[model samples]
Target: MAKQFERIEPAHREMMGRQAIFFVGSSAGDSRVNISPRSTTHFHVLGDLSVAYLDLTGSGSETAAHAKAGGRATVMFCTFDSAPQILRLYGRPRIDFRGSEAYAAFLAEHYPNGEPVGARQVVTIDLDLVQTSCGFAVPLFEHVGERPVLDRWAEAKGEEGLVAYRREKNTVSIDGLPTGLDEA
Candidate 1:
């Protein structure tokens, strides 16, 4: 069975919080559609209709590019254990780059410990629709642990090297769309 709602209910928030990972989907009309799996380390449920996650340094900034190009995004979370259900949030995304005030404030509020290393931006979504469906067909996987590779790599790169890397690899999407990283 599938159900739809205009806002995230408490049960929905619980499911989102319990999920180990989520998938982000976006597209800029003619460009390639982007789907990326993200960890929940910095995922935040800001309110009934808002959510956000920290965007770390990655090979492609397609999500940011798509957001810049006036695209909507869908974020999906599924239970890998316990009851089987999948939740999808459809919304418009805003990217707060590393040095922006929004970014700093978000960090201060949601990430009291401190921003994770290699954090490139914060992607916030103002959700318009929330949907849930039975995820009976989705396979269950055991939780192992978070990989330290990214943190190690980012730590090694440091701030200067990270800026250089973002400049090199994140300025453009695979389809040649400007990712706005250069401006950040």
Candidate 2:
């Protein structure tokens, strides 16, 4: 059975906390829909109807571009171990670029240890709907651990390299939409 809620419930938050990964979906209407798998290490539930996650440097900036152009996003979490449930959050997203006060506050509050090497921005979502559904058809899998490859790669690139790389590759989406990286 499926259920819908206006806000995230305690059970939903608990489920989200236990998950090792989540998926983000976004689109710019004229562009391709972007779906990216993200680690939950930086995911934060700010309120019953709001959530935010640290956006890291990647090969592309599809999410940021889509969020900028459309302001809509969906984050999905599913249990791969304990229970069979899928939770989806539909919301309007705002991108707070690095160097901004809002991004600094988010980093201080949720990641006081210091920002990760590839940290780029904070993507905050003000959710409009929360949906839960049976995920019995989804197969279970064990989480070995988060891969260190990204961290290692970022460290190898160094800060300057990362900036150049972002300038060269992350400034545009696959469909040629501006990703707002230049402003970040």
Candidate 3:
């Protein structure tokens, strides 16, 4: 059986806290669906109906562009270790681009611990519905560690190199959508 709610309760927070990875969902009207498997830094529950995830510079900026276009997003979490529940958060997302006041504040709050690495934006989801279902079909997998390659590679690139990489690799959705490229 599946359970649904209006917002994230305390129990959902526990499930969120223990997970290593989750899938982010977004799309523009009639465009390709963007489902990203995110795993670098974990998300933090802002309140009963809010959640924030750091968006590191990845291959594509579809999630940011899609969310910015009109704030549509769905983030899904699955218990891959102990329990067997699938959690989906459907909401409108607010994106804080890098160097913005919001991003700076978040960094200050989580800082020294949340140092500014290759972060590009922060997507905060305002929950509209919370859905939980029996994840009987999901295969359980152990979380070994977060691969350091992204950070290492990003560092090696330096500032200019990262910008070039984003311009080359992260500026477009696979379906030829225009990604909001930073002019830096």
| Cα lDDT of model 2 by residue, 1-184, tens digit | 9899989999999999999999999887878888999999989999999999998899998888888897589999999998799999999888898889999999899887999889988999999999999999999999999999999999999999998988999888999988787876
Estimate, for each residue in 6-117, the C-alpha lDDT of model 3 and write its tens digit: 9899999888888999999999777778888988364778889999888888888888778656748999999988879999999988778776888889878766575556
TM-scores of all predicted structures: 0.97, 0.97, 0.91
lDDT for each residue of candidate 1 in 14-99, tens digit (9 for 90 to 100): 99888889999999889988999999987899999999999999888988998888888999999998899999999999899999
Clashes of each: 0, 0, 0
Positional deviation of 46 in candidate 3, in angstroms?
1.0
- Rank the candidate models, highest lDDT first: 1, 2, 3
TM-score of 1: 0.97
Q: Is candidate 2 or candidate 3 better by lDDT?
A: 2
What is the model-wide C-alpha lDDT for candidate 1? 0.92
Query: What is the Cα-based TM-score of model 2?
Result: 0.97
Give the runs in model 1 whose Cα sits over 4 Å from its true position: none
Task: For model 3, state the Cα shift of residue 90 in Å.
Answer: 0.4
**Location of the lowest summed lDDT over 10 successive residues in candidate 2:** 63-72
